[model samples]
Target: MKKPLPAAIAGAVLAYCALATPTALAQPEAASAMEEMIITAIREDRKSRGATGLDLSVYETPQSLSIINAQTMQDFGLTNINTLLKMATGVNVDPTETDRTTYSARGFDITSMHIDGVGMPFGNLIVGDIDTVIYENVEIIRGSNGLITGLGNPSGTINYVRKRPTNALASSIKLTGGSWDNQRAEVDVSVPLTESGSWAARAVLAYQDADGWLDHYSNNRQVAYVVVDGQLTDTVTLAAGYTHQDNNSDGVLWGAVPALYNDGTAIDYNVSTSTAMDWTYWDTQSDELFAELGWQISDHWLLTTSARQIDYQDNSEIFYVYANTGVGLDAATGLGLLGYPGKYADERDSLVLDASLSGRFNAWGQQHQLQFGVSSARSESEGLSYAAQSGFDVMPPFPGWNGREVPRPAFAAPIVSAEQDIDLDRIYGSLLLALTDNLNLILGASAVDYTNDGVSYGVPTSASEDGTNPYIGFTWEVLDGLNAYGSYSDIYQPQYVLGEDLNPLGSAEGKSYELGLKKAFANNTLLTLALFRTEQSNLEEFKAYGDGDGIDDTDYSDDFDYSLYRGIDVESEGVEIELAGQITGELRLQAGYTHLSLEDENGDEARTFIPRNTLKLLMTWQPQALPKLAMGLSTRWQDDIYFDSAYGRIQQDNYVVVGGYASYAITEGLSVSLNVDNAFDEEYFSSVKYEQVYYAAPRSVNVSASWAF
Candidate 1:
């Protein structure tokens, strides 16, 4: 584990205090003198020294953007990354029975993930934590972000902004209990270190435990986060942060028995009476460290830089009954025989450099708001996987069965590879001109360079060099309180070695055009509509190159050809419409919807995993009218998927999931809340791969209470 430099720095500061505090207190007039010293210290901090130049308003931004504020998180009782996805627009998370989830944005792979504007290549493992108390907001920017984020898919970028300390001290403590013995507790605190509010700090801690709906399924999670900011002088500021999370789970409830009974009659997955036993267990942990420094060169120009490092590890055990049909059913329920089991480890490091300048300029007697920035990021990922057998017994097929591990795999040769490291860079410039009070025109473009190297289970050898991507966009304030915008962008992805002949693969290219409208109605409300088309060319795919299963020692190559993907997207897109400021006085309402249509131009379903249609809706009601009450409802719909497969054409029917929440105030600083997920207990499937169907979770409830000071 790498020690944090911030900790060492804190220790040194504390040491200095230990030696000086006593002497200062010893002075007879020290009490009055100390007050003056404290006052002076605060005045120094208030000189605007350590402040970031970045603006926080989402509307003032150039592209389509969304923000999930802290209040929205609590009203919906969204703690985990999965819950957040369900509540967001145009984002999808497909969770497999194996407990692995894949994320998708627009019509392309969701490759861009950031924390506070810095790229995080290994977002899969980093977002595993379920602590809503840690983040201040989730910021999403739609379209090519190469200019701001460097190397990334043109579909856009989503960044999780952490909580920061405010001058006024605030803290909250929460406790939760739910069905199936599920329980949780959390705390969040923020304070200023100086009276002048120059130095500030924030902290968050959380824990959760649950006994799942399925037999032998259980879960435990823990999280801690801390951050601090300080102003050193008139021109310099510094900030440091840390986060840690741990998760333990019994396993995922993959899927149930096939719909067909032995007699071939349509039957539900829950109706199967066949003898069965399966178990899955996994443990995952992660730690993150970050630091930043800001230098204000002048009033019109500024520079900022930040660095982050992430480390993660995982261990898993899976067991299930297997029948070859040709061979008799095996009774050996221990390791090595039943299902898939493996151990996974990952280490990643990242660095980011970002700087920008914005100021008003007079041209032809017209005032223009011009802004430009250059950003760069480099990241590396190293992960190792180990296969083993189960360590438990097989219980007969049933709804709820809890069993212990009966492990078996001994040591084996370690297969080592380095393929996850990524290096990316970009430079961008933009100019926005205010044609008139209600009219505006903007033009922007960016140039990017990216590279990747890695080997996966299927591909033993893989390496790709830097590829350039270009982007362009325009925005026009068409009418009073209405804005229209359009953009064109491109992105590229490399190839990995599959089975045989270095699978001939080349750079995959993507191009998209979008048009949207933003309207502000009476009473400070906002409404927006957007339509977009995206096409991808030269797509790389995994195809069988040999006669065998493509397993074992076989000639394989990183070879693929350009395929195509095209799709259209529509989103309601506005925020703070009904809930802008006044809602039942204290009651506030927020809501929106998103619709998407994606297509695989190759028409080869077996090669492309993209879905056709996705729909999402979210509504939040916070009644200040009652002073202490809040409620929310959320729904998601994924349309059917039809595509070409090796065996035959495959189709996955669409399904809908709904969730709701309600909370009440116990006092000015105390509150309680309840949440319901999959409220109808409806059974549905999210995906099907290799003829295997993965079902969604069942009805679940959670109740919580909180206190703040």
Candidate 2:
């Protein structure tokens, strides 16, 4: 009676009946005529999409998914989306300026960003419309999805998927350049409207520019997208979309400016030194609209309805100058010379609502699958600031020009006015139980309601707030490949504005756990190993104020309970080793690894600045290779990090990055490509500061051409 789970997937399909003969015989019997050889291996394994013995079965899906198709972002030339989200594996991407990019997983620190699956919470100007040449894949789900969505952010979740309209009539065009003077151009098109194609449409466009390496900085970008799909009467199916993104930058680059010399000695400079300071500036914008309706209530119940709308905006201004001679005149005569200034202004807005329902069931007899959802979000933010302290010739030798100020906006008081408004509502429900077919069981739960309304003008009056959160997880398939999962999520934040004006900052919480193992081999390879733990609670600290007359306001520190993190993750999760289906035929290969163990546990060692070891590898080769020409190679690595967690110091050191691409086809329509990135420039330090340090991105090259009519 307890053994019913599709008869344990029919007794593990008769005890792996000899590896199920490669999905029940992947077509053999060609008679002695022999000549059927088509190989194009592109299986950098992320769950090799296209299935095969289910990669050795036992996929309890408690979330740990990955898919980065689109021909591996056009064979590793990867355009944006923060360089293809660093190819998954606990994703990282903390650019912090030059259009600010932030996302950290497994150890938390991710602020929701979803497209084609809803949810895009402002900032960085919507990443220039997220083109990536129309995206046909890019799905990643790490852990803790609170039962299907409802106030998310468990350090995992990203789904891009767009790129519809197939049935022939494809198009593509791309061009790129790298290193300090980067440049880019992209365009993609897909068509099929009737002609028995069931209607379809797709479009993408992009433009980019860069001349940055700090020191006055520079960057400009633009993106656009359009999608359309239709079936209408055929059990109803319709999708529509629109998106536009823009970004402009000129400031924000605080890297390198401290080799000691504040009595601590050691200050002679020249490590390939660089500087040319300048007044700062940055601007951003974003827009999006979407709609989808898919109903196929029969064949196992399936219904989906989605709607979305978004708009975001940003503006920033910065300035830095302190060269009154040697170590900036010993910190401006110890600050009595008064010659440093700061200014900033920001605004944000958001609104979202989503609904979903999914199915596949058997109920009482076991074998089941279910997904239910509901979501809502509203946000608003505003901030304004100013700081001054003139004299000493207003310190402006060569920093984006602009000097002359002897009006201490209230005696160099700095920061003024801060505002916040937020309203959230989430409700989720999940179910996935096979309880036998080799043991599959996943349960979900979620309920969240949060609110915050704040203000600060001359200080005080940080009013209104609310909270609620709940979560749970499970997934078991303990053998035949092996799998074990766990989850416990929680979050509640309220600290008002970003920087300055403190004391009204409290309410922060988190808890997480994980364990795993997966293996498959027989030519088509894959391996996985994982262990994780996390803890965080109410940590809001900042204090500064004195009769010493330097004026910087805001202070608080006494609410710290936990802040611990631990990690270990490795994957190569095997299969066909490479070239996916070899242009519809088959062969593949891939690899990955990461290990980060950090600790703070209230002892306050000043929080170890992220990164504790990471490595990734990929390889693909399409057989039947010579005639049409196609090739690919990708490799990434990172280790040695600590960019100031309060005084921990040391930024992006130990590194390795290799990229490859090649394509050729002079007929049919037209095509040509060649790409290489970070071939080996390695100088490290993406960011770090006790005062400054930022550098990353040295080797790169690109060439592309395409056409189809």
Q: What is the TM-score of each candidate against the true structure?
A: 0.77, 0.29
lDDT per residue (tens digit) for residues 1-709 in model 2: 0111121221121100111112221224342211111000000111211111012222444345556778777777666688887756666776643455556665555555565555543221232224466667776666544444443444556666666655557777767675667788888887867665555687888888876654456778888888766555434456666777777776454223443333433334332333323445566676666666555454444455565555566655443333323333242233211233345565555556555555566876885766566667666666666543432234322222222232322324445356666666666656667767666555556566656665555344344545444554455656665556554655544433323323354444565555665554455354556565555554333232222223422211111111112221211111111111222343444555666555555444333445656666656666574767777777778766654322223444667888777778788678787877767766565544223444566666777776666
- For model 1, residues 1-709, the per-residue Cα lDDT tens digits are 2222333332222100100111122223444453444323332322110001123133334455666777777777778767786655666565534355656656554566766655654333233444556877776566555545444354566677777666568888888888889888888888879876667888899999987664556789999999887566554556777889888886543332232222322333441121122345566787777676654444433345555655566655444332222222222321111232334455555555555544445686676655465565555556555544332233333222334333434434444434355555666655666666655555555555555555554443444556455555455666767767665555554433342443325455666565677766565455656676666665433333232233332111211111122222222121211123223443344444555554355443322344455555666676546656777777776666643433344456677788888888887787788899889787765555323343556788988888888
Q: Give the candidate number with the greatest TM-score.
A: 1
The most accurate candidate by lDDT is 1
Show model 2 residue runs off by greater than 4 Å: 1-95, 104-154, 161-192, 195-199, 206-216, 222-298, 301-329, 333-359, 365-367, 370-431, 434-533, 536-599, 605-690, 693-709
Model 1, residue 665: distance off in Å is 1.7
Question: How far in Å is the alpha carbon of 253 misplaced in model 2?
Answer: 3.4
The 10 consecutive residues of candidate 2 with the worst lDDT sum are 35-44
**Per-prediction count of colliding residue pairs?**
37, 32
RMSD of each: 8.5, 23.2
